[model samples]
Target: MHDDLIPFNKPFFVGKELFNIAQAVLNGTIAGDGEFTRRCQAWLEQHLGTPKALLTHSCTAALEMSAILAGVGPGDEVIMPSFTFVSTANAFVLRGATPVFVDIRPDTLNIDERQVAEAITAKTKAIVAVHYAGQPCAMNALREIARNHGLMLIEDAAQAILSGDRGSSLGTLGDLGCLSFHETKNVISGEGGALLINNPELIERAEIIWQKGTNRKAFMRGETSKYTWVDIGSSFLPSELTAAFLYAQLEHAKRINSHRRTLYLKYFELLAPLAEQGHIKLPALAQDKPANAHLFYILCRDANERQALIAHLDSAGISAVFHYVPLHDSPAGFRYARAHGKLQVTTEIANTLLRLPMFSEMTTAEIRRVCGEIDVFFKITSKQPCELS
Candidate 1:
């Protein structure tokens, strides 16, 4: 038909998504915490070896639940990087806690663990480590800071479902971890997430919060004869329909991760020449951290270079876009979050970072084509045009 327009992301579906949904519907339990929901939660718990896992409508819901469990409130401060998804800070802000924005490590674009320690104050209640681009941050350093300050550590692992740090699961290292199954994430459920409870003490309370602040989960387990509202919470559980769709994806999560990893390494291999020539910077990963190959991005020399490259890709019918508008610079951030350091790294990456097309269904030829466009853009910009199609 027409030149195939590559999209930034394409949601993948395994064979069982439909069948599982039909099965869930036929089972007559469309509500949440049904068979499929339990299955997904069990899968997460078993895979991550966490004490407990509770499904939610979205990663945002999971973060909010964690914030409630952390006892975050007015006058409390949570340290997090400004380069992350807003939910990382919004979750705590919803409970009246202030978000202290810090700079990110220039190498991995992760929250600078060193800066986190300096930001902690008497008002600090927690530290939220956002694993940028599915690469786990220095969880060990962040953990030490949290323990020293008596603050809770939360992993906003929305992009790092199966990643690890130093042989340990990425999300499982923190006191609380949150995962996303959004359309763009490695796993797809349209809209779903889970709260990963590593701290055994919070297991019972976390379950209660997932069940609309009631002891319904306890009742389901026969722990209580009757359930009622016992704490302040919300309905965060995902419906069986969402869980069924997610369960299908979870069944093939390893395969999906493998497919994406293949694409990721290929991108690096194809673009390494440019990086060597100092034309662009590829993703940097620490030796101890293993990525889940969630998204592939590059850093241009400057914001203008990034814009021109995006334009060239657009003309080639390829989707290339920038990411994150430095939450510290956003309007809501100004109102609810306070900047701890200069946030220079966050500001720079926010301007020059360009995310390339990534998906399980994308082919190697499509990836090569995208790389070709990037090479063309740089050559033409440097006034040394190279012809290739």
Candidate 2:
């Protein structure tokens, strides 16, 4: 093993990143939506095949823009899974809409499509489907429900960039989609995101919302002499420096994805036996869906067992961590869902799920070492006696 502990997620940077950022700075336009931003936007549109896109400071900003564009407001209800990053719900909640929490599928851990329909109400405005850990949700089922209810479908593809299924991109399947380039994601610009406007009608309004509520973009296009505030908006656009950094990542998207996929599969192959032995449960892949292999996680018997495994890994100088304590039990989400109902699966998985280290830079040797340590932990604690080689 290496001298230093393996961090959970290490952002990989190519040689061109700093150079591009320097160019952005030296070009005298470090502000948002400059040359680099335009380049990045063009790259996204080409890669994702979305009709339009607007770069934002973060995924949360992209989501906030989606809420505004969707006309979500007070008295409106948005259906989404409770087992997600708070930003998923917070974006809609900030717009004064109540989030109707749904349970997750125990297999893939993505939002339950069946439960989503039952959660829909007359006030439902949108359905935010989070592509949990780079796995695509059941978009077809969700789409049917959304169409039946006449609600907007928003894809929170924060962890699912470059992930999709059935000829549909993860984010592009919905009315609007959001992508994150956070340090933790497969791609990194330190902190940045983009909103994918699949609908042509939403493009103009999406731009207006991104440019701080003004028609400045149209003005610059020679459509108008002057621009003014025409809608509720905020400063959501990201600087050219961030876009420049992201462009480097986007340029190497295939390479980065290939490396991450290698590591993801390595973990799965090494840990499958332990799962079969009843030591831990590995995340199940859906046969019908395609995924980006963004994360590799296992569910322990309970919270205590999960904690013990984490401690064991730590003792061996490996760093492993748990993720998302089901939003229904979270302080803010619980308060918001006071009148909704209980989230049984959400609460249960929150305690059992433990995310393993996954990054594009991780070497196969390092993955084997990490899996070996986990195997040792399970053997020492399992019903069967430990047999050290």
Candidate 3:
């Protein structure tokens, strides 16, 4: 990669991350569930209004824990969008559950709630809502469907931290929610995640699952005489060093999200003319459902145009990229998952979608440069040129 290139993402620090790591080392408890971990969990619970939040090594671990808590096993099926990351389906697949992949909405590129309803059967155990690009999914509709069918509702909110729908945090709306603090996310923890428990009944078991199936958390609180393996689980919790780094990011989450939102809007504003001219499709935005601006992506006319745009941006020393390939079409998807419908929308979006450079520390000038390059690309390709204002 070129030194001056505006890469797709760049991890940033906003607070005393190194200082906190040093403190964790001095405290002599660098393992999981240490003081730093407690602080991070408490911060999430307090902000999201969830009853409990348990930090984990990655969003994948959180999803795996949610699958176990939902009692999903062999013969059970989990409904989710085919446009999402592999972890969304892998968690349930690991538990011997079949992933029932569904199509996404053409506008938001999120799981279509209607498709989810149609995919349900007697064997269906849960519905996983992945908030793509930090935009909230149709949570109200999804919740209603889950309630009517008596199934677990899990939010794979890896890209959604401060994002909300109708005034409620994305992760807190479902029975269980998963968050990612990966470097690419608005909050930087190098590699970490958290699981938010909304259903009060799942709290106790969730804690046990987070602690490697042991009652160590209760023992630490002086509630248990001894701790031992009591249920099915794994080492899902992240170490104190990771938690310490995350706590710093969590402290400045609002500021980070705000800056990223500003950048997101800038891209939208600069590229609106092209969208109006039908050169591209911008991501759908809603007032009531505010996003954390975790990512900003646009859909070109087709896969060929997307590839051309990426190459054009690269030539200008700006790095842009494409998102996920539909999981339903992958080799593992063929082996472990099944599609509910034609999934035409998923395939189309997967082929055309291109994610531009977006990060907390990204500057408005950088966004303009990226947008300007995109304008040039369209001008060279099309007979009618659209100017970037």
Q: Rate the local accuracy (lDDT) of all candidates.
A: 0.89, 0.86, 0.91
TM-score of each: 0.97, 0.96, 0.97
Residue 197's lDDT within candidate 1 is 96
lDDT of 1 by residue, 1-389 (tens): 22699999988787599999999999998999899998998999888878889999999999999999999999999999999888988999999999999899888899998788888889999999999888888888998888888999999999998998767887899999999999999999999999999999999899888888899988988989988999888989899999999999999999999888889888998999888777888888567323889999998878887898898898889998899898899999999889997888889889889999998899999999999989888787774322211
Weakest 10 consecutive residues of candidate 2 by summed lDDT: 380-389
Lowest-sum lDDT 10-residue window in model 1: 380-389
**Highest-scoring model, lDDT:** 3
lDDT tens string, model 2, 205-291?
Answer: 899989989999999999988889998899999988899899988899877887788788788889889877777777777673326
Stretches of model 3 off by over 4 angstroms after superposition: 1-3, 288-290, 383-389
Instruction: Kindly report which residue stretches of model 1 are placed more than 4 angstroms away from their true locations once superposed.
Output: 288-290, 383-389
Better of 1 and 2 by TM-score: 1
**Any runs in candidate 2 off by more than 4 Å, and if so which?**
288-290, 338-341, 384-389
For each candidate in turn, give its C-alpha RMSD to the true structure in angstroms.
Answer: 3.0, 3.0, 2.4
Looking at model 2, residue 9 earns an lDDT score of: 84
Provide the clashing-pair count of each candidate structure: 0, 0, 0
